[model samples]
Target: MKDKKSAKLNLQHKQHQNGHLSPSTFAKLLDLEASWDKDQLGDVLHWIRQIVALICGLLWGAVPLVGGIWLVAFLLISSGIVYGYYAIILKVDEEEFGGHGSLLQEGLFASVTLFLLAWTLVYSLAHF
Candidate 1:
């Protein structure tokens, strides 16, 4: 059993090295256990926030969400995900990235811009 497991792992590693990861192996690669530099981590957080913004904008527009509540919700969800990823999942030191404020603020403005753009576009096309 141990040998078989080791062989399977080796095969998976080889497959990954060849740039052909299965879904499960790909998911494992996203687990965030590898060491990351400050810039790389910040970039990851920025992209993650951007993706979250796009999805939330789409959903909000689809649901016809309007007013301040939706904006508040978007802020909460986007910040919450970034917090959870760094603080909980990655377990990185907040001070290294210049505290929670700086880390959370990464890509915030850009993501908000993206979110507003997507929301208005979707809402206008769908509702009006």
Candidate 2:
């Protein structure tokens, strides 16, 4: 009986280790993060979004286009990626992320920055 009990307990422990995150640990981590400054979170998200935008811009720029038409696609795709990640994956509230205005601004800023960088690279490569 003692061996059976110990074996059952060991099995339970192993199951816990192999299974999904414990609710208590997940809740505790969320509680710890909740104490963080909202602005800091927004800033971090903003920068990450910008980097995504830049990457999208570079990829879009790689395709040949006669005009600035690629920019529209870049803006849409980059913003979608950032918004999806934050709103769906992270479950971040708009209030914590500095509202829609900030989000749009960040997306625009990133798109423009990336556009400029891509343009410069392409121009240099073409001329040289």
Candidate 3:
């Protein structure tokens, strides 16, 4: 019985370790948005953060022109970070926009995917 319990506990711990953030931790992150009053500036800031990943996609396209590979790399990493911040914004959007949190997540995912794709295209096109 003891061994079985230990094994079960270990498995549960492993599952959480594998990128499985708990709702409490995720909810704590979302708390940041709660401080903002549902108003114009708060909405503006939310939009800006949500668009960071999209901005990275645009930045990656310009990398080839000026040899801004480092800059582009920085933008890509920053975009990922901003997407995380936007996740918090999304939670707030749930309250403000009637549970449309996935919209921001989708935008971030799409923008990150396109950013990487654009970078890959630039490399292949320039080389080939």
Best by lDDT: 1
Best by TM-score: 1
Q: Which stretches of candidate 3 lie over 4 Å from their true place?
A: 32-59, 62-66, 69-118, 122-128
TM-score of each: 0.75, 0.56, 0.33
Better of 1 and 3 by TM-score: 1
Clashes of each: 0, 0, 0
lDDT of 1 at 85: 89
Evaluation by lDDT, superior candidate among 2 and 3: 2
Of the candidates numbered 1 and 2, which has the greater TM-score value? 1
- Residue lDDT tens for model 2, 31-124: 4344424434444456656676666545554544435666676667667766765566556677765786675565467557866687557645
Error of 1 at 9 (Å): 35
What's the residue-level lDDT of 85 in candidate 2? 55
- Per-residue lDDT tens digits for candidate 3, residues 5-61, read 999999997676443343444454446543433332234333444456445545555
lDDT of model 2 at residue 73?
Answer: 66
